[model samples]
Target: MSTTTDTAPTAVAAPPVPPRGGVTIDEWHPEDEAFWESVGRPVARRNLIWSIFSEHLGFSVWLLWSVSAAMLPRIGFDFTVSQLFVLVAIPNLVGSLIRLPYTFAVPRFGGRNWTVISASLLLVPTLLFAWAVQTPGTPYWAFCLIAATAGLGGGNFASSMANINFFYPLRKKGTALGLNAAGGNIGVAFIQFFLPIIVGGAGVFGLVQAKDELNLERAGYLYAGLAIVGAFAAWLFMNNLSGAKSSPREQLAVVRYHHTWVMSFLYIGTFGSFIGYSAAMPLLIKINFWNQPVPEVPGIGINFAYYAFLGALVGSIARPFGGWLADKYGGARVTFWTFVAMIVGTLAVIVTLRQLTPVPPSEVPADPSTFVYSEATRAAVEANSTIFPWFLAAFLFVFAATGIGNGSTYRMIPLILQRQAEHTTTPETRRADMARATKESSAVIGIAGAVGAIGGFLIPLTFGSPWVTDPVEAVKMAFGVFAGFYVVCLATTWFFYTRRVTVAGRAPALATADV
Candidate 1:
């Protein structure tokens, strides 16, 4: 808790909260130990909890189509693997674009008010998804349009992060933000994990079907109900803080900072990779690891959809640890190494892809009466079995690296802003300078988040359709391209932040004082 003395009256009872509608706290001094201990802590915690709930629902809604797309075959949708990739990829494209406007909405409408509205907005996509999926003959254009609406969930992350930034003291902000983000990130994993079970095969608890069946529309209905809960909870419990308010000019000031753009470019490698890889993994597994049953204890021929959640689960869980590491080490140093790990991990995947032998073309009848099987054809299935575990491990490493990079890159932003503040401001104006720096950092974080999410759309497109003529070769090519991008990120981090440069007469750090 903060230890500063407060001139305001010591609360004789609990602090007063707004009585009607959503609560609004007009006075917030989280930096003042007395105010924080007395009034800020509880209010902040309450807002954070509801924010997590709302954001969590948003992520699940945003990625809902990914799981559903994998089930399209069973549903008789009749889309090619390429068409399905486009179906899943459309949401990511829409979601990335939605984040920018969503970021601005927090300040324009008040965080609590916007959270209620944004959470409620998720209903559109969910309902459309359900309605579209219920009819197998739903036109591809209609499905694409419906999928785009899911991007509403993606927008929630930016606004939610920007809002929470205002609720905590500087010392606690990193940890609080890390927890909030991790809570949302895990929702992707949870959707993937529960989707197969919810759509049900073997009727684990008799809540669903007993035989293998695809109830694709169930995914949409599940999240739509959760969206309602999120909106209601935000309306009933969350608070809007007056201190967190910002004008367009102040928020836009971040655009003038050169580091903002640089960090955004790097973020494309971390967050972009994380979200992109996540959206693509279900399809990748289904297409590449085709012959293996997902190891059901009581059943045979279980689909691989059950295990698709593991990549996202590990990635989301690793994110907080990444932030913590960045806090201990310098964010620049941690981020640089994260890029290194990502490069190595992706290369491993490419190598694994290379090990698989391609299926040969069918030979024409030798004597016009009989055909012969090529050796390559006979060995194709055996090669898949050989490469599955190795491929899984390589991709898991990629996921882990992206998760860590997401945390580290974000942790770096605030410190870089603080360094800039220290360099430009006088000692007498230091407090005000730091506040401005924090505000600008918040803006840049939103922008970087939106920019980074573009990776999600690009990755699936890069890999071509899941049914590409040679999926193994396509994956190899895609990983090679991704690895090259990481190398660029590593060099950028080292050059801008980790290396010391002389300003005036002395060497000053870009990430100064354990930053």
Candidate 2:
């Protein structure tokens, strides 16, 4: 019997496999410390890097009109100040409207699939821009239609944020999201800084000579090429997580939460302000501080293209720092203080605006190359130049506050939903509830992003209101309204999350949740 005995082989466990490109990951456990250390971190980092690159290009395409609108006159497009402002505002309006659907597309399709689709969509706007600028007979309505296509780029932020949200644990969400957002936000600065040089309007810090004539179509061609590269990168490097799947009805259910709407309102004060101010900054500077072909001097006034990029640069850099502060202190705490700073900055800007005399619409020449400035117009330009430093400093301070608020407000969303889930779950069901909460948080982020973007449309339109006879007065009125809105935002933040309040025996206070 011993000689004839047969032996059976023992089973051996296999090592975990790393995530592969363009593949669907069926298992993901980012919240697990051991799993995160070994696999989740690397996978998350890889997706985030490509997400940022795609989103950065998206943002640049979205704001192509921001820089382009200011240069239209030099390129022989005769449009009024109000009309130029409309060109910039149209993209924001379309972008905001498309964001809700863009958000849901991530979970419906897959993060990787949607990213490739979105990145490819950017070519539509860039190509349209190229065609519109190059065609001599393009009508104003046709230009508006082309600008509306740029909104395709704006929707990218919503989907990218929602996608990245699913890849990180609660502890790292603040930093991860902030870095991703800052990377995209910096695109505003990138286009503002480089487009003028590309279009032959200005040089690199005035050190390099610009082309003899403006060529706005060059900007379109360059960004179009970059958009193709972004699509290829996403297709090659990104992956879809099976765990992120959700139905549109389930995602839309997040809107029922009171906190969702509250966050949307607060985001309007932060992100809305950032995008809106970015679009309006160049035109504001052009109208207030500089006049092309100054009276006797051919080119002797403050060039807006030279300094317009600085505000976005400072704001983009500050966003990550704000997220770090929120992680250490608390998101609500950081957001509240940011609003206080915004109010003060807006008031400072108003003071600077009041110091300079407004340039009458009648005085602004339709043909800059063939016009001369009157005594009054020349003095107004001189006064504007003197007050320019104070104005720029104030606006920069405001942009910094908006950037900080943007980071902190977003950090608060995931924490708030997580707390809600904890209060509603028992020990047996905690994991399932927590997973649902993550999905809700992502949905809420998309909603807030969409609502906040509406502010971008409102801002430039307010500055160049067709109904308002005086653009300067309209701008001053707009700042006053903005300051009032920030006061409401400050109070709302305190009332909801910062203050100690009980909610139907769910939890002691939201503040205790570290939101």
Candidate 3:
């Protein structure tokens, strides 16, 4: 009864691998018929590392405007405050629109192909930014056009997350994703804080007419060179991870679960606030406290972007803590507290704004709070004295809440999915479905991440334009309004998940099957 007892020697297949770093062996098989992984896992992880780095560079380029716009006036570019906001907001607007479709790019094109193409696209805007600043003749149209190309960087986060999700286990996803996301988010702070010092002055990207003013043409070339370095690094080190599946129905079907929608909205609070406020910070410092002595003992005052990055740094630091907190307590519980804190933070800013000049700003007053003639700012007349600490406190609170939200939202996804799996299937089937959900949750996470990042762009534009007495008032009013959205998000969570009568506790059958 022996099947095919022909004694032909069977050659055992060897594992495949990337070119051995120090050891060289040709004809490697990663997915060998016998050992389908050993070789493959190492290669997959290497690719993931590179992919995250390249995407990180993309984000740095995308939000470069947030830092650079504050420099325009200092660089002798003829831009008004409104014009400055418009310019800063250009990339934000374009980047947000691109994120919706970018999540699907992976399934359509291999992640490898798109990564290469998208990474390459960043060069366009970087080069253009260098060019625009060089020539004063550069009309607003040209600036807007160049900024539009920066959106390419923003879209990379979506596709990259979608691609990476296909490569790992479910339990490890939060760590993996948090790393990838945090890497990208840090870029805003990194560039903002460093650029002023590196550039040697605030507007050094442009001509050096005054200590503060710079020529655009010179700055353009410099920034372009830096972007080129980033592009080259991406191309040389990054690997495209392919052969993954995350169709809209496959990935976004999570939306069918009302909880997914709730999470998405809450993300607008946590993530949206992070993104919006990060971009606005630079402008806020310049408008509000320009008259304050530059903190640099010998150097230029704190650059707008530099000040803004503090908020981001705090936000980044808080993310892991948020995740850890969610792990210990339920996401719903953590999120409820985040709501309370953010509301308090927003109110602080509003109170700060209301207190600015209890007497009219125009009245002949020696009030130290006012930014009047005797103390004209290095840049311009400062908007208010107390605005600084108030804004700072507000930013700190927002970042803390957002960090909590990041952890809570991420924590909720798997629990929700796992709970659903447990309820919907037979014991045997439930185990299998739960395993499947563990994997699918990764994809859902990737899609949600990309979707959540769009808030970065949206939050800026939303609060960027509103209540624009100046950038300072604009931010305060905007955050106050933004806080209301967070409140609504809190109510939604309460209405759905935390509610005793919710499908979660009430009709357990529907919770598992539907979500």
User: RMSD per prediction, one decimal?
Assistant: 6.7, 3.6, 7.3
Candidate 1: Cα lDDT at 83: 84
Error of 2 at 266 (Å): 0.4
Per-residue lDDT of model 1, residues 1-515, tens digit only: 87986698766876654233377877777778888887778888888999999999999988997778877766666677788888888888988899888887787788899999999999999889878878867898998998899988999988998888877776676667777887888889988878877776423223444355567678788888988999999999998876667887889888888888988899899988988888888888766655321221121222456567778777888887888888787677888889999999999988887776655555454352345454555577567757778988888998998888888888878778877888889989987888777777778889988999899899988876454577667777788888998999988887677666644655545634256
Whole-model lDDT values for every prediction: 0.79, 0.89, 0.62
Poorest 10 consecutive residues of model 3 by lDDT?
291-300
Quote the lDDT for 68 in model 2: 89
lDDT of 2 by residue, 1-515 (tens): 35776788887866566787788888888999988988898889999999999999988988999988988876778888999999999999999989999999999999999999999999899989999999888999999999999999999999999999999999999999999999999999999999998888774557756566778989999999998999899999999988899999999999888999999999999999999999999999887788664332354457888888888887888888788889999999999999999999999999999998765433436664567667776777887889999999999999999999999999999999999899889999998999999998999999999999999999999889888876677788889999999999998988887777645644345755269
Q: Write the per-residue lDDT of candidate 3 for residues 24-121, one digit (tens) a residue.
A: 22233332433325654565566577667667777777777877787765555666666666666667667756765676666665566566667777
* Deviation (Å) of 170 in candidate 2: 0.4
Off by over 4 Å in 2: 1-17, 293-299, 358-376, 501-513
Candidate number of the best lDDT: 2
| Stretches of model 3 off by over 4 angstroms after superposition | 1-45, 202-243, 246-257, 291-306, 355-387, 414-454, 462-473, 503-515
lDDT, candidate 1, equals: 0.79
RMSD of candidate 3 to true structure, Å: 7.3
**lDDT ranking, high to low:** 2, 1, 3
Candidate 1 Cα deviation (angstroms), residue 344:
1.1
Better of 2 and 3 by TM-score: 2
Error of 3 at 201 (Å): 1.6
